[model samples]
Target: MAQQQETKSEPFDEFIVDTEDCEAREQAYRARGTARPITVVGNPVLHKECRDVTEFDDELARLVDDMFASQRAAEGVGLAANQIGVDLKVFVYDCLDDEGVRHVGVVCNPVLDELPAERRMLDDSNEGCLSVPGAYASLARPDYAVVRGQDAEGKPIAVQGTGYFARCLQHETDHLYGYLYIDRLSKRERKEALKQMAEGAPRYETVAND
Candidate 1:
């Protein structure tokens, strides 16, 4: 996912997760998982909508763990399953909100909620993706957003946030739907972003599309 610069903190205090416990929880997942090479923009897996995650078994659990490892390895705040070449509706995030409060969790079969016009406050901030490697472009996204999904164990949950965390949630969801942030840009902007990627190399291992 991308690092957002439009962190206008909203008062969603009731939605805040247990950050104190998140550090230990995040480490436990990362500890049990192996980091895999991330898939780049041209990969087929990243171009199509992902399959829904039906079985909440050990395999799914392990995938979540691996996603956290992969996200950390890529130095990204959030990642979707297809980002690692898995065509499943799953994503993991370890991001901080506008207030610098850390939130960590996994969402399976995630769905973003439709925001009403009143809540559609556009935050035009620069965004970058791990899959796109070294490109970034300013995009307009609602500062406040919400998502409904299940946990690693398949329990129902809803997560909402403001600023950077909101962008993380929205970004990962878009990945599962086979839409990169560049997809939202103008043709010129999109071409510019791809050109930037062509000129740079990712620090971490990446899966070559070819």
Candidate 2:
């Protein structure tokens, strides 16, 4: 998957709808808002394993671009292909904080080479996603992680993350494996979060998937 340079002025064409599914897809995409649930609970696209990335062609490149757009549109820091109903082992991360800085790259055909046998946990902070709409929770995750994966160019790359980046990587990786952030939360927390989801908060899932 080759990385495409996105101009600040021009909109991303990757996730945009075409003449075929414009109305339905565009409307469905718009329904997503910031409050959308992270798809942590209820029939999540987990269990089904994702295939590895082998080719880095035009389509793969386009998909990466769309993933970035979807992530940004959803106001998320990272996203995986599986979250958008594509069972490919690809994810995009914006190396930015909540303050809206941008460090960009694509992670393709990722392989989780290492995880701490003894995990280190952190506080449950608000987390959301583009798959499930109008939901969020203070989910717990590890503080550090080392992931070995391939870049868009098919080069073997290993990157270690700490702090929020580590947490975001783990969360997005979980999406690749069909896991949701809610799965990592306690039963009580899930109940509360689901309540907010039911109330229909504005979130990105509706916008991206629509």
Candidate 3:
């Protein structure tokens, strides 16, 4: 019998995990007992472009809390609303080290800004999603990017990220656009990776209608 994997704890404070230590962060995600089925690429909620968040009340706060809870429960670095079957432009991230944990925040209505041309491409990195259970794939992404959005408190903000945060931002933003980690790979790679992912994974079907 296979050894049972240990699940991560909740109320993620970012202080416990150092995101700057890529190896350690990856290990944390890997340690997550199992991958949970996140809404897939063609799911109507994922495909239907999310609307800009307009309300900021207790309800929204609760949703934000739940998003964070889900991210922690899934042991993911970032999470988007669409992945959870909600068609809304909302995402939460905590890409920092134990010392720099406060940088983590939510992005409401995220819009990508001009990334320095020199920083556009990055080496392929292993990526996974909550929606695609038990699937991990290497995906190529930019090393740096600029994102503009509003915070949970409804304040406008612009942030620039490099390294892991940049990669995560791109991935989460892709979720908002109905793209999955597999879509970032080359056609040949996607074919092979997806085949392997589907073998032991639970069945998932794309939603036919948006």
* Steric clash pairs (candidate 3): 38-130, 38-131
Q: What stretches of model 1 exceed 4 Å from their correct place?
A: 1-18
Q: With candidate 3 superimposed using the best TM-score fit, by how many Å does residue 25's alpha carbon deviate from the native?
A: 18
lDDT of 1 by residue, 2-43 (tens): 112122233456343646698899999999999999999989
Task: Write candidate 2's Cα lDDT for 1-210 as tens digits.
Answer: 111112112223422111244334333433442222233344435445677788888778767766665665777777788766666898877654334433355667654434433546564567775555567777766666555567878876655555667777777778777677776778997777678777886544442322
Candidate closest to the true structure, highest lDDT: 1
What's the residue-level lDDT of 4 in candidate 1? 22
Off by over 4 Å in 2: 1-47, 97-102, 113-123, 205-210
- lDDT at 181, model 2: 74
For TM-score, candidate 1 versus 3, the one ahead is: 1
Quote model 3's TM-score.
0.71
Between candidates 2 and 3, the lDDT winner:
3
Can you rank all candidates by lDDT, best first?
1, 3, 2
TM-score of each: 0.92, 0.68, 0.71
Better of 1 and 2 by lDDT: 1
| Error at 126, model 3, angstroms | 1.7
